[model samples]
Target: MSKVLIAYFSASGVTKNLAEKIAKENDYDIFEIVPQEIYTPADLDWTDKNSRSTKEMNDKSFRPPIVESTDVSGYDTVVIGFPVWWYTAPSIINTFIESVDLSGKTINAFCTSGGSGIDKCVNDLAATYPDLNFAKGLRLTGAESSEKIKEWISE
Candidate 1:
């Protein structure tokens, strides 16, 4: 029996839906990343060119607060999920990784994106957590594609 942890940061509740499905399908414990200031659709307005999200994405010093952190030591494998932001994983993801010390564990990442592939994002995660094994990601969006995410987790 392999114990797993499913952790994710979702905006507008899209990624949260998929994250929940995967967790239920695998019976894994789930952790949601709640930033100090929640994001709304207007906040995510990319066209504004001055939105908080755009600012955070442009700068690297922003550290969003994670409401509830977890202990990853008990789990053999970790499934990390998020929505791609600016061709990379969200900066709050840094908060999640920093909260837990995953020195030699297996981590799988999945994300829902508009048109960006996850190669660069996975590379960044690998570089950040040099000691862990990061499995390839599942990139999809919408309810119809969430089934694929569940299927991949069961694999």
Candidate 2:
């Protein structure tokens, strides 16, 4: 059996729950991609144009600093989970991706969103890091079943 790593960044605990379920169901190691400066509830207020998330999302080149790095030496498969922010993965995901060498690893991207799908997020990641293998990305909710995650991983 190949070693799998479920690495995720959760802003509001939605993606965290999904990642935990996927990890427990697949018996995989899990890592949380925490930011150096933790986001406050006010920072996450999307409706306010002056909010941190809003400003960060507006800048395409901004890569938020991560608190720690996870060594990806032994993992062959990685599942990256996050919340959909402005129809894409948070800038922190870029920081995490660039921190690791995932050239030949199979990457499955997933996100928890209220109504958006994962197509744009996946495409953006693929364009940003051409060498990494990004498999089909999934849009999930907290209510998703382990069997569903298993099937998605298998795909």
Candidate 3:
């Protein structure tokens, strides 16, 4: 069985494109972490303090509900991808992680952002879930070549 699973939460299509590339190159299974209530463009506005994204980012314990649950027991390694939200993974990501039992699995995190790196996102996940083997994460643009995806996965 293929032991790698690429799971991701992508509000916009940017992270989804990158996730597709990584999954295709690695011959891995892919799963989309969809939110129960989809975010509209207005809801995603970070500038508005009352916006959904802003409110979620402000509350550290907030967990945006995901549409479905996934079992990670079959996969030895999980590659999680998301857009960098307030310098970290989205709260829905926390909901996803908390739902699965990834105790001994290797977790490789990747994100897409306008200009920010994924250091804080990686660090946050590691700190929150100390048991999982958290691999170094990178910010990937959808334009990355197959060779680049292979290199990132192999690392």
Q: Pick the candidate with the highest lDDT.
A: 2
Give the higher-lDDT candidate: 1 or 3: 3
Off by over 4 Å in 2: none
All-Cα superposition RMSD per candidate: 2.3, 0.9, 1.4
Maximum-TM-score candidate: 2
Tens digit of lDDT per residue, candidate 1, span 73-114? 898778888899989999889889888977776788888888
Expressed as tens digits, the lDDT of each residue in 1-155 for candidate 3 is 44889999888798898888788877999999999999999999998999999999899999998889898999988899999989899999999999999888878899999888999999998998888889889888677787876677667
lDDT of each: 0.81, 0.92, 0.88
| Candidate 3 residue runs with Cα over 4 Å from true position | none
Work out the TM-score per prediction: 0.87, 0.96, 0.94
Ranking by TM-score: 2, 3, 1
Q: Write the per-residue lDDT of candidate 2 for residues 13-48, one digit (tens) a residue.
A: 888988988898779999999999999999999999
Candidate 1 vs candidate 3, TM-score winner: 3
Backbone clash pairs for candidate 1 read none
Error of 3 at 153 (Å): 1.9
